[model samples]
Target: MATFATSEQLLVIIDPAARQTDGESVRIAKDVLSAGAATKVCLPDGPEEFARALGRRGSRRPVVIGDDRALVRAVTVLHRARELAGCALSVVPVGDTALAESLGVPRGAVAAARAVLDGSERRLDLLVDDSDGVVLGGLGIPPEPVRAAAPEPVTAAAGRTWYRSLVRTLAPGRPRLPAVPSPGPSRLRVEVDGAAVVDLGQPVEAVSVAPGTGGLARVEVRPLSVGAEATPVRACGQTVTVIGADFRYRADAAVSGPVRRRTWRVAEGAWGLTLPTGS
Candidate 1:
């Protein structure tokens, strides 16, 4: 919850995808940043250069000008490097903004840049998996469709696609869990903390794990149903474990795993992001 003074020195990294996707917004973000502070801009073509730029970011605060995917990349990169604790990150969301908006980042380039220069820093909670994957908001299963009307077919490739559709941005070379065979809905043995909430006896329709109130992770489980109304069970805890046949789950924007199981623990206030003053 540290408050940096106005016109703070900043390392503004613009993701290539952002640059290609929305040059106008990028321009607006650059102009605003250029007009506001002592800024060093890094235009990295890919993840390596992006990582290298951040690794050498000296005393300047890191400001990302991109979409949610870019923000996720920056967070994951910094978290893996163990430098997230001291970093107060900012973003000028330039593309699809669902994730950024969910995290309280304003929706447009001008306002977002203004936020970077004038807003306050917020230490936020994140979820980290055993594979060291980090989620800024949350992850869910029965991988929700990017478009609800586009019913995705169940197949091995589709399982990977399902995971990827929800997956934000993953650093290149990161190990991806095996894709599950997708001929049917997975029956996951889900547990919140140590209590079993969903068992293998029932087919699971969906599952969502998110940071909940009281610094705990919230877990929701929906059992499959044909005729009756399905009741979803909910619980809160610091950790959630899912065990069953090889299954896949969406984390942030990325889908991962066909591993027998995976566990996620809440990392309370492990990182910070800049938002408007009143937010």
Candidate 2:
């Protein structure tokens, strides 16, 4: 008679980032996982190998041992193959994990690996874009600005401007220097679930969209120059479309676009993630 307790089997894909950073953490996770499961490990150097590693995942649960971006990459691969819905994914975050934190994945290699061994699967909603891009956590319109390019090493004109300022310090009759122009609010035509919420003529302070339960994305638009009491417009819908001048948005950890238009629709319970029990 077979006396060994049945052990779960897992294919652990160790991302390049995990191998490069916190090697000890990765080792701990590997040790714990090996002890609990029948393990097959794939150390991929880049995205191509990563996808291939997952593609060859046969009869084994796929587990990712990297940070948030690694999780997104795995999801995208399975998504493109249309296999995500049937496959459950587990992640052991080992790098900057803003995405993991937002998705409620427990931190620490040991705990996360344990979750992989003992946790249950939870089906979650997703936002799929027109470009076939996937948004795991959420997306922001007109992403936080990048640091401006270094000023032209103080040239003659700038020196003259400084001289003018010094002269003004000695004389009250000098004209004040011109101020640098700040950016104005963005102009976008926002639509939700076939209803137009804001038009192009209306400038917006900010835009945010996040996945919600039951196949919907929570859409919010902050209008520019509204009264102090005017709150942002918030609604839930299945589709969100934005049209305007070229703009960019931050999705997960990456920034995309300067495109004229973008649309996202919800796919309900599109994928399953392994989460700690009672979590």
Task: Give the TM-score of each candidate.
Answer: 0.86, 0.83
Score each candidate by Cα lDDT: 0.82, 0.83
Candidate 1: which stretches are off by over 4 Å? 148-184
Q: What's each prediction's clash count?
A: 7, 0
Across residues 1-279, which tens digit of lDDT does each residue of candidate 1 receive? Answer: 567786568999998877765666788899998898989999998889999999999999999988777899999999999999999999998756678999999988899999898899998989899988898888877555453224435467646545443332332322333443333566889988888988999898788999865569988887887799788888899999999887777777677766798999999888899999879
Best-matching candidate per TM-score: 1
- Tens-digit lDDT track for model 2 on 1-279? 112222867899999877665566788999999999899999998999999999999989999999878999999999999999789888999866778867767888899988888888888999999999899889888675534323323358647445534543454431222332324689999999989989899898788999999999999998886667457899899999999898778787677878899999999999888888778
List where candidate 2 sits over 4 angstroms from the true fold.
1-6, 145-184, 226-230
TM-score of 2: 0.83
In candidate 2, which residue pairs clash?
Answer: none
